[model samples]
Target chain A: MAIQDIRNYTGQITQENPQIRIRLNEELHPRWAHCDMISRYLGHLTGTLDLEKLEKSEVAELGDSVNYVANELLENAIKERSGGSIEICSGAKGHTVTLVVSNRIEAAKSEKFKASLQKLFDGESSLEEKFFATMEHNEAHPEAKVSGLGFLTMMIHHGADLSWRFESGEPAHPGRVSVSARLTASVF
Target chain B: MNEGNHSTAGPETDPVVSGPEYLVRFSRATGTVTFGGTLRLNSYDEIKSMVRAAVEAIGPTGVLTLDVRQLKLLNSSGINLFAGVALSARSSGTKLRLMTSSEYSWQSKMLGTLRKLMPTIEGA
Candidate 1:
């Protein structure tokens, strides 16, 4: 069966002028379809293109990391937005790959998202501790599990840096949040 | 050449639903459990219970060789489950050795981290 296009937004992926860019409209594809495609494409490109400087294992790991990070951000964006579209953009400059996911959400949700960022910062010392803590917390209160493990995995496992923007709401709409992550490829 | 007793996991013998999600084979004679395919939340418990039982049956002196080279796509929760099994083996004085392939980097990265959970984890 064909995939259900729920979002109905246009998406584009371009690699021109020595840079790679992947832009997607949350309205175009399902939660993880876009991420899966981009990661697979990136993996293919790495295998067929100029990524010979990196080892075979590194290329595979990079693809998996990209897929996981993109999926995490996309899922968070969908949950944050009650009645708005999400825009996901990823670009590669040299060996650093950056991903940004943006959406509009309620003020309270924005506040909660920001608070989770602090927990990520605090747990930077031990990945295993953070993972188990998140698992246990999720086991106790399932609601708190949202985006917790995803953000932590991006930081601890993939060695990515995460930053966010929570813009206040306007007169008619809720606040807008944009979470970006910068991951330096561990190719060398 | 020589044999004690060997068992493989499948639809007939293994209780775990082994299909697209994951496949597990336990060898009682050799104390080896091999895992394959993706391990997700749905089939997590099946694999864990199988491993746990296999570890216990192997006894204290036997070495439990967990070969996860073909097992791909383990989510965070699945990794946590694996950590539990590895640590249980450690505490029970059952030697746990992990066999992994060099092709999949996620396995190496995650399994390497799991080593810290069980300091004596071999071939991680």
Candidate 2:
């Protein structure tokens, strides 16, 4: 699915009201490529995306952070379903942010997929784990065209927290495997 | 020779000027041209120009050794540029070898992938 179509799910409010909400819905398989594209698309759609709109150093930091988180989130989706679609609902309240990136995983792929997400989260909890994870590949998505680093970049470097829910029955609101994240500005 | 006939020499791999590598007259005798420097997104444009120039001068029958010892990082955009170089060599039937020390960032890993994607040259 296209990001534009996904936007219909969350009803975006990029215009700095009290929060920033972005919804991305897409299919599986291209795991890394989709995350990279959607991330960039949101980056463009939100033009100067951030509460403060960022300066030189801050913008650089933001880009790297988002890239990492993107990798983590994408890997989480691709571990299961070969052709399942994903929907990511992202929202930010002040310095705190939330992104829900979910995909349409089948019953057969649900368990393994959830396990992968949990594993990624446990690894991300520690600094060393996050560091190593960023450099390594997701064994699950072995045939992937690109190195899987989008989610790691976002979480490890960008201050985003990863979370997801895989529901196989009734496929939940048609077709979408949802994976989401919550990001907050760094304290320092 | 025929000034690079289409049936002969393929899509151009940019040429590497020698002045930057110490005025070593870049003639048909050079055989292979090696570059040493950064390969960030910004430097990719200059590198491409140099590569195409080198490939053109090196001709289809010759070989080019890309010394990546100095190339530390490459952004996604830079990766595409590098891929194009490899593709050009493949389509044109020229030989391109990339040599890098162990100190490559995650970006450089894309080089290995590019090499794998195209079986024409070598080293992925």
Query: Which residue window of length 10 is worst by lDDT in model 2 chain B?
Result: B1-10
DockQ each candidate and list the results: 0.17, 0.05
lDDT digits (tens) for residues B1-124 of candidate 1: 0011233466456433365345678876567888886553322445556788888888788788988899766555556666677767777899888899876666787777767767788885
lDDT of each: 0.62, 0.46
Lowest summed-lDDT stretch of 10 residues in model 1 chain B?
B1-10
The C-alpha RMSD in Å for every predicted model, in order, reads: 8.9, 12.5
- Runs of candidate 1 with Cα error greater than 4 angstroms are A1-38, A45-61, A75-86, A103-106, A123-148, A168-176, B1-12, B19-21, B25-30, B40-46, B56-61
How far residue B68's Cα lies from its native spot in candidate 1, in Å, is 1.6
**Reference-based lDDT, residue A85, model 1:** 65
lDDT of 2 by residue, A79-151 (tens): 5444645544444454444555555566556665546445555642664355343333322333444443444
Give, for candidate 2 chain A, the lowest lDDT window spanning 10 residues.
Answer: A1-10
- Model 2, span B5-121: residue lDDT tens: 121123453233322222111224545444443232212334455566666665678776655555433334344455566666766667876666654433345555555535655
Clashing pairs in 1: A7-A27, A8-A27, A9-A27, A9-A28
TM-score of each: 0.68, 0.43
> Per-residue CA lDDT of candidate 1, range A1-188, in tens?
11111121122222232234455554564343344345445544543433435676666666677666766676566556745667666666556566677777776876676676666556456666877565555445534334256666677788877676666885467877767776666865
